[model samples]
Target: MISHMRRLLSLSTAMVMASTAIAAAEPSAELIAAAKAEGTLTTIALPHDWCGYGGVIEGFKAKYGLTINELNPDAGSGDEIEAIKANKDNKGDQAPDVIDVGLSFGPSAKADGLIQPYKVSTWDSIPDTAKDAEGYWYGDYYGVMAFEVNKDLVKESPKDWADLLKPEFANMVALAGDPRTANQAISGVFAAGLSGAGGDVAKSGEAGLAFFKELNAKGNFVPVIGKSAPLAQGTTPIILRWDYNALSDRDTLAGNPPVDVVIPETGVVAGVYVQAISAYAPHPNAAKLWMEYLYSDEGQLGWLKGYCHPIRFNDLAKNGKIPQDLLDKLPPAAAYEKAVFPTLEQQEAYKEVITKGWDTVVGANVQ
Candidate 1:
């Protein structure tokens, strides 16, 4: 009787260990089967080079054998919003499963009720500041606003907000575009405002206006649009651009026109490239799967390889996935230690301040 009891106990222990191993080994068979049934995913994206989305498409296709159809819009965010509004009814054929756009447009997209809320399981891994509370959208990558200077143009590069105001940089500095038109340009203006460029503009409309007026007087202003490469190639010596865009230019112009990027001593405003799912998406399940994959450890590391800061900084740091050579290319993490978001109050204030300021300062001065 004792021998028989020992055999029964040992067999039960082996059965429990086998069950635990199976649970740890793979995803549920149900999920894999559902993904196979989804068939395809369609995406609409801003005008990023193939390098930006290529890896993601390849990864998704290899894992699920699903087809990915991508559409690149020629017009900006306004055009994308207009397209969605026009096609709200017959969505599957007309609308994309997912869309990517600039940061400022994220709130507007949410307000229009064009986006759906679906937080990935990895949501907690992303910082709260980088994502919407209700999961309407989340930022995948971001660039810090900085000065891209030509080494040959000025004896020394402008190091801070105050340096641009000097007489020496007169007619030598250029901005991306009118703040009313370009999201990046607006970020630059606000960053300057936050750093005391226009006195009290951090809290008042008059401050932003006064700063632009001073810039106009110093002859330190030029309005350039859509072409940062030519500007860095020496058409204009000093231009405002995001760090990655500037780095791309610097890499392209290795010997000629030699450009260098610097985060202004005052502060850096981080502008993001955000992604969201369409409210009327045909493949909602697949879209959710894509977002989940994007935030996973594998997908987040891809962003670091592509030179865009991954949204989950802590995860990347913990994994040691960010290489030393790449770390050398980026601004010190301290530069982003105190980053601030533009509050709803600031966005409202900007509509009036930036528009009116342009009329008074840039419009009056343009020949």
Candidate 2:
């Protein structure tokens, strides 16, 4: 559910957000030809609406005239790596050529020898801290956690994490994913605790567990996988999701049920997702080409339209490459100002705490 890195200088990283330089390398003609020759590019665990991947995929296919062999739109980061491992020797349609996963997964995947390395043409545009020095993985886009509320069902949305504990919210609140596995849900737990812990990243993991335990005890927590469908149908009126997902849900619903995406006043945590070519990619050239397209300005803006802050956003904005309309589509710049970006180490540390303790501490099994 996340890539996740970089502190905000409003739009993520004070250094990155202030940079005005723009460097882009063109894909070699031979590489483009080779990728076209491959004819198809396999991708796993990319939901069309998440991070505006729907438009990005369509744009890629339309631009390259190559078929995208998409697999497991609902699969998690773990499933993506397993796909590569399972198909290491297979060269058929079931094989995946690339993956977009959580930031933590990138290094672990590289360590496991499950991913290959290829620097995109716009590689220099991404922040150094957000990418692998060896080019094993690179941050693609990121967003913070938010409350996606069905306005048709709930009159007043929770303004902060504590507000969700109100008696009125009973059986209404839900997590977008199973905290035991989904990065989005795990981050949600961490964010909840951050406000309670006075912004202590180290203590958020445990504090989040306590917060959820309390919410569950109050019968305000719904043990259900909160998705757009569930939310629209009122099964889960308030779902914790990445801002991009929540915004996309609002646009998709089109006011039929109305949606309100709220960035809590406290405990703002951002997560970055990274991309990499598979180690055993059958269509390696195509995978590299896809990377090039993803890092391109066109590709980055596609994500912006979907409400994700592309990893290269700082450079894009400083150079005036980002359209004003696109910028306007985002939630207010002020809402993002105080976001706390947990380092990869902190994310890993908290991830272990939450994933390992969610059951025993919170005791609500999200389906």
Candidate 3:
């Protein structure tokens, strides 16, 4: 009789564990109905190819059948926060329901009351280091900086940050965004500085400014915000962006332009982009539902398809959720070995030095 009881107890424990897992993955029926009633979610600064957001967005729409009103596909991380701040009083089309921005912007956005807190179902799976205690924002994905070049446009593709300044690259090199407001562009400057400073992160901002100043003076730099289309067309032959974007661009170009995504030999800086809902979100339920979809296993894998390392990577890997083929497609593990992640303080400090000095020190207004 005791043996029978033990077996029943074991079966009950297994059932409870299975049910708990199911509960975490699926949203509450009430939340889903509420989101459906809202019928829309507004987002800002989400380029389709960046970080595999294109697929993720499609999956959400197909699942929930809600219209996602996309706003400003090319806007920067700072611009996303500004959108929330500017539309605080207005809850209609202009107000964004959600934002995906750089790591440094998370705390600032929360402190400024531009974002509200809502922990997703998979919140615990996210690393504590990458998320806020109050859940205002959490890391979505990360990638190291790299140069994406149109191989057909140039005889020889440069391999490092210094090579971009060579005369051969004259009128060819472009930053991914305006350093004044774009996190990617600002991080591009910081990465170049890291290369210039021989990896002293504290000195990266000043060193980056000097590097761009020279790139501009030598007529090598293209003063424009860059995108995959521009890179393929040779308008901007060389663009500094996250490795994931570069890889995705290469795939999208698909040998017509024959792109090369190269990780610099030095100054390998990795940046993390975070996700949050707006404090003044018009479709608050849909926004929360969107967050749920992003942090879910399916959403995480979508980002992986775009070549980004999702913030929930560790948890996914530990559970054997990641596919072998997906892992095989990424750049070699060795290339990422030297990647350095900057602290929030370091990024914040350098951001001030870079943004405040870009106009005066670099003297090139990137449109």
Candidate 4:
């Protein structure tokens, strides 16, 4: 009797799991209606070589027969934010339909009341930690900070956070830029902190600050801003950069000095590029449609082709959509399986830590 009951319970649990997934997969009728009424979408994005935003835009236009009125790619998140603030009042004519900004800027945008809430029908597809409860923004693609070492410079690559501090690597390491100025660099700092070097902004910024100070003292730190390609090409042998960028660079230079990307054994810091609809969007309908499409399996696949991790993890797993060959290209998916998602609390705490710490440790003597 006991064995029979246990088997039945297990079967019931499986059925419940299947039911929940089916319900979650269903799209929202209300959003579909709204999208049909609106005929176009306009978006703003920070410039990135691997985001695959162009492919996403083209696909949406082709599918919906809706014009993507604008795709404004600014130099950085700060520039995109400035454009939104400058046109907040003109909801219908001047404001953008959607905006893609770095993870750090998402909270600031929400606090400033520049973002509007509209949960895409595919909301359940996104990881809960990656989206706001009230639906202000949602992460679409995330990149982890990893070591990009030039094989020619060092016969043996650095495999962990501790390896970066070795005497031999002195004056040879370069970070993207200061955390306050660049999201990529800030992510590297967070990864360092997570790796046990000390990143608790609330308790103490000492660990993170000291880590940089030590690097500075050893002359291992090279401050490069804006362009990372030149640094990767050979001017600097080892660089702290996102895996996608590193891999994309390596793919581009197959015949040249190869760049090896490694996720440090200690831990990795993941930075997410998120999407939000402008509070005063001029093309609200088109924007809603774009959001819906981007969260779909088709959109997620586009991201995979561009070498970005899809936001809809479950779909990717169920459909077996991610190519096995590309899967081999990435760090074990398990490495990122339980990856940390930056919270609003963490972002707020680190903002002060990064800003002050950057001046004292990095910005004070930049070339």
Each prediction's total of clashing residue pairs, residues at least 3 apart in sequence or on different chains, is 0, 6, 0, 1
1-367 per-residue lDDT for model 1 (tens digits): 2222122122232222222222223333565566568877877643343113456667777877877866553334444566667667855655678877666677788998998998776665555656789999987776677888888877699987668889988876766554654566666777776676433345534554556578877778765542445565555688776676676666657846777778887745666667788888878777877787777666766665555676654545544545677667665666554455555456557645765577755563321
User: Model 4: per-residue lDDT, tens digit, 219-280?
Assistant: 77766542346555666788887777776667766837777778777646667778888877
Backbone clash pairs for candidate 1 read: none
Q: How high a TM-score does candidate 2 get?
A: 0.93
The TM-score measured for candidate 4 stands at: 0.78
- Residue 143's lDDT in candidate 4: 75
Better of 3 and 4 by TM-score: 3
107-220, model 2: which lDDT tens digit per residue?
A: 889999998888887776788878899999999999999999999889999999999999999899998888887778888999999989999999999999999999999999
Pairwise TM-score winner, candidates 1 and 3: 3
| Stronger candidate by lDDT (1 vs 2) | 2
Better candidate by lDDT, 1 or 4? 4
Give the lDDT of residue 254 in candidate 4.
81
Q: Could you arrange the candidates by lDDT from highest to lowest?
A: 3, 2, 4, 1
